[model samples]
Target chain A: MSVHLLYAFAGAGVFTIGLFGMVFMVHLLRKLLAFNLMGSGTFLVLVGLAQHRNGVDPVPQALVLTGIVVAIAATALALVLIRRYFHLTGQVTLEPGSRDDEGHS
Target chain B: MTSWLLDGLVVFMLLATAVSVLASRSLFRAVVMFIAFGMLMALAWVRLQAPDIALAEAAIGAGLTGVLLLDAVAHFRRGPDKERGGAS
Candidate 1:
């Protein structure tokens, strides 16, 4: 296979792994990590596939650049929200019984 | 031949780190693995002939995001009581 095709396959694997982690992981931070991983995987597939067909495309690369910036902003915002949630609830995971005393108040 | 070997190595490391980021026992270790994954991603971008992305991945992906997540990890490690105490 071509080099770009190899990277594209790798990206698919990463995306699947991230999807599994996002679904199964209990901790919000871990979920956020999985979300970022998924984004990265998508970016890789975009660039790799585009370049695989058309030899060093600039459009997809630019798109991925913008995506990376947006991703960091989203991650920071998620971390802030997570910290606030932890401060109020004292729980990391969103599983039930995290706020038993409050009782959904 | 050498280039293909190098590309394969980078891809392998990328997947390995991505898995470890989820599978790690400790939260801090997981975040650290994520940072390493970002750096490897930068290398992958370089191999893909996206130098601009490699730079951004190195700066934002590995450096800034790593520091941000590390700070959050430290905050979580402090426990809610301590954080509340310090905040108030």
Candidate 2:
């Protein structure tokens, strides 16, 4: 297989892993990390698949560049929100009355 | 031959770091692994022949994001005490 296709498959694998983490993990910060991983994996698949077919296309590359910027902005906003949530609630996980919240309250 | 080997290695490292970022018990260690994952992703971008992405991934993805998350981790660790003090 071509190198780009290989990368695309790898991206799929990464995306699956991220999805698993996002679903199973209870911590907000961990969820954010998983979200970022999902974004990165999607970017990889976009560029990899496009390049595999079109031979070094600039369109997908440009798109991925903008995507990376947006992803960081989203992550920053999420972190701020998480900090605010923790500041008020003193708990990291989203679940109300979770085991982690027992001692804090 | 060498190129394939290098690409495979980078891909492996990328997935490995991604897994570790989620699997690690310590939040700080997870964030650190995420930073390492970002670096490996930059290298993967280079391998995929996207130098622009490689540069941005290294700078923003690895550098800026890493610092942002590290700060968040620290805040989360120490947040409850400060909150208690403020609340009372």
Candidate 3:
């Protein structure tokens, strides 16, 4: 197979692995890392697909650029919320089982 | 010829990074592995001829996100150091 196609397959494999980790990991930080890994894999696949064109695919590249910025903004906001939850509950909180504490406070 | 070999090598590194980021026990180690994964991902982007993505992945994927994660960890450590549902 061609190098670009091989790279695309590789990206897909990594994307699957990252997806598995995201769902299975218990820690909030690990979940965040896995999510980012999946994101990187998606970006790799997009860039790999762009390689098929004779020239740059400005569309995918621009979309991925916008995605990177949005990912950071979301991560920052999530981290802030994670910190706030930890401070209030005295625990490293995850998504589930934390709602009751919020209602009490 | 050599580019193919380099491509395979990078793919291996990518897989390894994924495994390490998940398998690591220490929270700090996992975060470091995640950063390394981001860097290797940038390399893959470079190899794929997307310099803009390489740049963004390096900056946002690795640089900015790393700061945010490390800050989160530090904030957690400064507190009571308890697990989510344990001992509280």
Candidate 4:
């Protein structure tokens, strides 16, 4: 198979793994990591698909660059939120078990 | 040819590390594996003919994310909140 074809399947596999982690992981940070993995998988597919007969199209490259910047900013914001949550509640995870506490309040 | 062989190896490494990252119990080990996964993904990007993505994956995905995770881990170890379940 060609390079694009190989990476396309790889991209799908990565995406699936990331999706599973995101759904099953309870930790906020792990979820964020999984989210990043998912995004990277999508980038791979986009770039892989952009390959034309002779060369790669530039649009997807530009989109990926934009995605990278966006991903970083999002990660920073997410980390900050996690820090804030810890500072406020002393909890690593916002467990559903804590809803009783919320209900009492 | 060497090209296909190398590509296969890279893909294998990428998927393997990804699985390890998810399966690892220790938060630190998982993060470390994640960084390695990102590097392998960067290599895959290069192989797929996307140098710009490779650069971004290395810098943003691997480098920045790794530092961020390490900071979180350090804070987790020493901070007042303490470790709860689901750290891994």
RMSD of each: 4.0, 3.0, 5.6, 5.3
Using lDDT, rank the candidates from best to worst: 1, 2, 4, 3
> Clashes in model 1: which pairs?
none
Stretches off by above 4 angstroms in model 2 are A99-105, B83-88
Q: Give the per-residue Cα lDDT of candidate 2 at B21.
A: 90
Query: DockQ: which candidate is best?
Result: 2
On lDDT, the stronger of 1 and 4 is: 1
TM-score of chain A of each: 0.91, 0.93, 0.77, 0.85
- As for candidate 2, its clashing pairs are none
Report, for every candidate in turn, its global Cα lDDT versus the true structure.
0.90, 0.88, 0.75, 0.78
B22-87 in candidate 2: lDDT tens per residue?
A: 999888899999999999999999989999999999999889999999988767765656744643
Report the lDDT tens digits of candidate 2 across residue range A11-98: 9989998999999999898999999999999998999999899989899999999999999999999999988888788778889975
Docking quality category of candidate 3 according to DockQ thresholds: acceptable
- Cα deviation of B34 in candidate 2 (Å)? 0.2
Off by over 4 Å in 3: A53-55, A95-105, B80-88
- What tens-digit string does per-residue lDDT give for candidate 4 at A2-73? 777777778888888899999988777778878888887788778776673346777787898899889889
> Over the stretch A1-105, how does candidate 1's per-residue lDDT look in tens digits?
689888988899899989999999888889999999999999999999999999999999999999999999999999999989888888878896663221111
For DockQ, candidate 1 versus 3, the one ahead is 1
Residue-level lDDT tens digits of model 3 in B65-86: 8888877765555554444544
DockQ of candidate 2 compared with the true complex: 0.63
